[model samples]
Target: MQTAAALRHAQRILVITGAGLSADSGLPTYRGVGGLYNGTTVDGLPIEMALSGPMLRRDPALCWKYIAELGKACLGAQPNAAHYAIAQLQRIKPDCWVLTQNVDGYHRAAGSPPERLIEIHGQLSPLFCQSCGAVDPQLSEHLQRPLPPLCKKCQGILRPPVVLFQEMLPERAMETLHEEMAKGFDAVLTIGTTASFPYIHEPVLRARVAGGFTAEINPQRTDHSAAMDVFLGCRALEVMELLISHI
Candidate 1:
């Protein structure tokens, strides 16, 4: 296995991370055993319905509940080594563009700037009013004690800025991702999340479609793991630290 060095040294790198990246940080993602109600009581409300655009339009309180849960869960969470590795890689390769499907703000907290990071799923930092269309941003401190951020103007319901189910990925961001893949990036790294699985796996799929080498960092054997030229199976943080040392 050629260490992540070669990939990290690429002229143009496009690194896409998914939910798995945050899993090590004590965040609960689907396919994990731990979560609200031990991931069991969510029968009536699948993730999509609870976080989709239409649902937000129908009931803002649901979005509030979702964000509230996330806020609560994030209280004890900290950025793991994998996230720092991404930042380190970014510093090594300034031209690289990093994209992530996670809504959690760990990457940002880990020092990845907004300019270099593309959060495809949106974030929970801001709250928007579905009625008056008012928007406000909340730093981590605000979330500790309160309901989800509310619209100051109309007091209308407020929801987090995530790509809910039935919502399309931000068009501008997707275009940028496609352009990089089409231009034939030197290396494409998929990290920690199901970006190696069915969802958020487009970049890996693109690499395969273009005959480009692929990299995967995940603990499980995702469907496309076999296709990757390099597979680092473990916590993303550990894999990243190893890869960074080599780089």
Candidate 2:
């Protein structure tokens, strides 16, 4: 495949991913069928509001209800072929780095090195106490506890470190992304995302401006579709499975 040809020739590649990357593992996207944003909660608030930082602070119980539900859904899900493919690619190409919008932590679970993987959205694996800054990596255990689980260190409310609607992306992740972009890349590969965030598309745009290859794999057309050198219209897992064979 031409996409594979591009990837094989590239030394330093930037792989950007989004929610669709984990859909095959039974995780839902943010704005699609059965997605978290598709419906309202028991209190009639939109999922966005229910999951926002303001709501978490205003009504921890109400917020935790949805958070616990989401955690439950993600608890048993495993990394799928697409995730493994990315990890394998990174293994073969040591210069590959992944910038993912997923908070599920499947990339790390799939053996993608933490040093090369940037979770643009904070992950669900680490729950932090907003009051004391204590962290609990056992998110599943806390999900099974009372609503708005408390911190073991200071008995304060605990929350997943995920970036909420009202919050900005993690500063460190952003800084690292800028650093990576400044260093330039040989190619840009985007998978499963609509490229709604400007930062998500920035690297690809930059690489394209620098005369580097740019490719996208998505089931549906996205804002970046017009600019991609290769647009594989298929599920991420299916596309990655094929791409891995060529790599």
lDDT of each: 0.71, 0.86
Count backbone clashes in candidate 1: 5
TM-score, candidate number 2? 0.95
Lowest lDDT sum, 10 consecutive residues, model 1, at: 32-41
Candidate topping TM-score: 2
TM-score of each: 0.85, 0.95
Candidate 1: TM-score? 0.85
Predicted structure 2: lDDT? 0.86
- Residues 56-145 of candidate 2 have per-residue lDDT tens digits of 899998888877766776777999999999999999899999999988889999999999999998887688899999878888887777
Clash pairs, candidate 2, are: none
Q: Model 1: per-residue lDDT, tens digit, 153-240? A: 8876666667777888777777766676667667777787554333346666766677666787788877767878888787687778
Candidate 2's displacement at residue 11, Å, is 0.7
lDDT of 2 at 69: 69
* Minimal lDDT window, size 10, model 2: 29-38
